[model samples]
Target: MTKNGHRPKIVVIGGGTGLPVILKSLREKNADITAVVTVADDGGSSGIIRDYVNVVPPGDIRNVLAALSELPEIYLDIFQYRFDTSDRFFAGHAIGNLIIAALAEMKKGVFASVQELSEMMRVDGHVFPVADEPLVLNAEFSDGTFLAGEAEITAARKSIKRVWVTSNEKNEAEMPAAVPEVVEAILGADQIVLGPGSLFTSILPNLVIGNVGKALAETKAEVVYICNIMTQKGETEHFTDADHVRILNAHLGQCFVNTVLVNTAQVPEGYMDKEKYDENLVQVEHDFNGLREQHCRVISSNFLKLKNQGVFHDGNKVVEELMGLVGRPNHELRHREHS
Candidate 1:
């Protein structure tokens, strides 16, 4: 509960490994959490399943569900279990992904199916897909070349100039719009969080959806961007934290981010296992003046958690700062209070 004696409604938008870490902590804090996940994944198990089944990729959604689920650990473990390569038929697919795929077929759509499964799993809060259907992420590189699909875009590794989404279906009349529930959640949220995930893929895919972007621009929520702790090699190599914000604002056509949470703790040299976490390149360089020029409030702290030689945000510390932003006035008033 906040100072007002009410649960603060937080809508976290993004998908990938990073999103769930924050969600699990938020659940512990008892915030009203809504996870708006990206549907633009086209890699690994998700890619294979989405291709054959004609359903939205379930990998990201499966992880988010597990993060917020109230089920026993054993049950969740079973749900999350991945098949071994020896099992050729089910190889590489998590049980939860298959289950979500089945539910999608039974429920006729991903949106309704997630809600039904959320109830069954006794999820602590809402989990909404950015759109009801699969969205293909398309990108234009600085070289003026174009590519489609998240995997290919990342692999091409050219500097990303911009990204947008299109319906996966052929002959689609128009670009996909986010379902009403997603937009409503954004508009009604007390606080909205953008990332801790891939800048062009996980995070931008959700925002490129037409209605989702519109609602974000129009909503009164204090939008917060949890900047990525490290630069992704293929996606954001040599990029500063402000470059991440700049890309997001460039895509959205407005500086929708109100505050940015940056990790100040340094990762000891040679600590990260490069072979295992190959995607991560280095710590994200800070550009406070650039962030200020973008009109974003900067909150820098030791939000780092080093585990198994990987650097990530310390969820509890990040959430503490997020909760502080709740019910607070604009930056001017906040500055006055500090002064």
Candidate 2:
């Protein structure tokens, strides 16, 4: 609980592998968590499912649900199980993704379906899709050329100028608006977190939703951006920590980020398995001065955890810093006592 004896309300807005890592840690904290996940994914199992099923991509949402679930490990393991290549019909698709897709079909909307599933799974907190329908992520490259679809954008291997989302439905006359629950979560949050994911594809896709961006800019909560530890090859190559913040601010036309969490611990030479984690190019260089110019408080720490020859944020350390920012210095101690 917070100093005032109420659980702090935190809204984490992003998608991809990073969001779930933080959500798993946040589940143990004395906070009311709301994960506003992106619906713009169009790759691998998600893309194939979207094309055939005509539903919002469920891969990221499936992961987030698993992270916050209170179900037994064995049940979750089964839910997360993926078919082998030998099973050609269901190959490469996780059972959880297929479940979410089925629910979307039955419920008639992704947002409502997620809520129902969250309850059945005994999720610790809320999981909201940024929009009710699938959104196609479109980008304008630095060379002034345009590309549509997340997969193609990344495959082009060109510097991205900016990105936005459009309705995947045909003849849709309006830009997609975020569900009321998502905007309410952001506006009522005690703290809001942006990203530790792909800058343009994962994070921006959600923010580019008109209402979501408006709610973020109007929210009174402190917005904290968890900067990516490594630069992504196709999206943010040769970028610094401040460059990430700069692009975010440029997209919103305001410095919405109040703080930035940066990883200072360096990966030893030849530590990362390049073949496996090929998307990551190098550690994100710091530009404290640039961050200062954006009026963001820079919190530098060894928020690094290397495992399986890959680099990632130390979830415990990141959540510790976040709890402190939310005025819960004794939260860890209290949690330990209870445990």
Candidate 3:
């Protein structure tokens, strides 16, 4: 709620590229948002910090902060800068990663640093790492073999059979305490968005969080899933929009989703040839017919457009479609003030 007194509260779950994009779009609608990001990132700067610091992985959390940022350009640029020199140890680190690491060291916690940074960024909505504890995601194959980390699971030649969080005998799985705020947002929300990212790694990791999952299941908010435009190489090689819903249901079980949003526009053949995207590998063809077969309502529109050198939803179009799902007006009043 703000001075003028009107805005929808929204809770979005996922991480990586999709979560940030969705957050950016929703923020444009002036919705008060809380992004519950996956903490299972074990690649690049995030994995390095998780291994050394033993705190919730900060990389994905940092990305979400940047996406939600509505600040000046210089500050945004500085936050995203990555050291690319031949200095092997720091070569792949991002400026935000180091800032977060230093803050964690000074404040004695990851969430504390995130809070400070969030304030500095003047983010329109709040962001939360799915769990405060460092959670290592483990993958298990049907043959009963276990892979220890996200990287290993990705690199494994065999397709991932299933994934789960790992913990010692004495502890139980739990979301970071901040997660209840996410639930509160959902319970009060007009809409809840799931993902446009990796099914297993980005979206499901957050969904499987203890209370977060239950809150989503029970919330009266209209649940909407922004299906991925392209299937991920190792994770969802041949998935369709319907396949996305099925996988979410498979992991979270039935009734996990109510509506699925898909791109109705067809990709140009010339563009596909120019980009050399593996059409056979994982393409999102308009398949609402297939999606409806899964017992979920399907809404399709021309959501795809070229942006940032890759295809993405014309953010405005995607948000408009989503708002329509819950009977909200597609107007600038989207960012209405609250009393």
Candidate 4:
């Protein structure tokens, strides 16, 4: 419950771009939102920062902060600004990411720094990293080979057999567990959202944490998976809606997802600019029968939003369905309080 009163607590567990899209919508609905972000990224500016500071990559964290921040437009813009490539010193870095890195050093941990920053940004919700320590994503390819690091795994272009996270490069057995707050948030949530992000890299990196995976299986909360809008190349290249959910079950060792939100909207033939939407390899074919066979309640809709020829989930539409799934809110009381 918020200081205002009772509100639906929705814990969204995933990282990357999709997490923030839904979050931006849910914030307006006054839900007590908690985002459990993945920190397994080892590419681009995040990887650079991680190598330098030994703190969890702050790129995803920075995006989540911008999404949930109730700050002025200019401030958020400046926070998100990335320097030009020609600028050697600051090129490829988001200002918000740098701020988070500084805070991590000052507070002695990522969690405390985020907690303090959330208040400073006047965030309407809580943001928790999946693990307190840095987690390196490791994958076994379908061809019986192995790879480490998120960038390498994706670039290999082989079908992913399975993925897991560990804290140490020297010892694979040393996997970091999820912080207590992360598990507690999922266990106590009224609703939990699984994805809309990269199946292997963005989403799994978070769930591969031992306690986070276990909590999903044990939590009584309605676990709703917002299926990805488009198939991701080198990851979910030929995956179906059911395949996505199946991967989640396999990772967690149980069929934990209670509901699946899928997009029924069709993408025009060759409408997607391959250069623009590089990762979007194909439309995820619907497998309603397979979902039913897996005991999942499927709710399909035209939940599509096209921008620059890239397919994205209609965040507002999806949240409406989620809100209804959790039961009707006390609109009169909520309105009174907000007003």
The candidate maximizing TM-score is 1
Q: On a 0 to 100 scale, what is the lDDT of residue 231 in model 3?
A: 65
Candidate with top lDDT is: 1
Off by over 4 Å in 3: 1-5, 142-144, 167-178, 270-280, 285-290, 328-339
Which candidate order results from sorting by TM-score in descending order?
A: 1, 2, 4, 3
- Order of all candidates by lDDT, from best down to worst? 1, 2, 4, 3
Better of 1 and 4 by TM-score: 1
Error of 2 at 324 (Å): 0.5
Task: Write the residue-wise lDDT of candidate 1 on 1-339 in tens digits.
Answer: 787788989999999999999998899888999999999999989999999998999999999999999999999999999999899999999999999999999999999999999999999999999899998999999999999999999999799999999998895678899999999999998889988899999999999888888999988788889999999977999998889999999888988888889998999999999999999998999998888888888899999999998988898899998888876754442232110
lDDT of each: 0.91, 0.90, 0.72, 0.86
Q: How far off is residue 267 in model 1, in Å?
A: 0.6
Model 3's lDDT to the true fold?
0.72
Worst 10 residues of 1 by lDDT: 330-339
Error of 4 at 147 (Å): 0.5
The TM-score values for the models, in the order shown, are 0.97, 0.96, 0.86, 0.94
In candidate 3, residue 169 scores what lDDT? 22
Model 3 Cα lDDT, one tens digit per residue, 186-260: 677777888877787888777766577677777777777888877666677766787778777777666567777
* Candidate 2: residue pairs that collide: none
Q: Which ranges of candidate 4 are over 4 A from the true structure?
A: 1-5, 169-171, 328-339
Over 4 Å off in model 2, which ranges?
Answer: 328-339
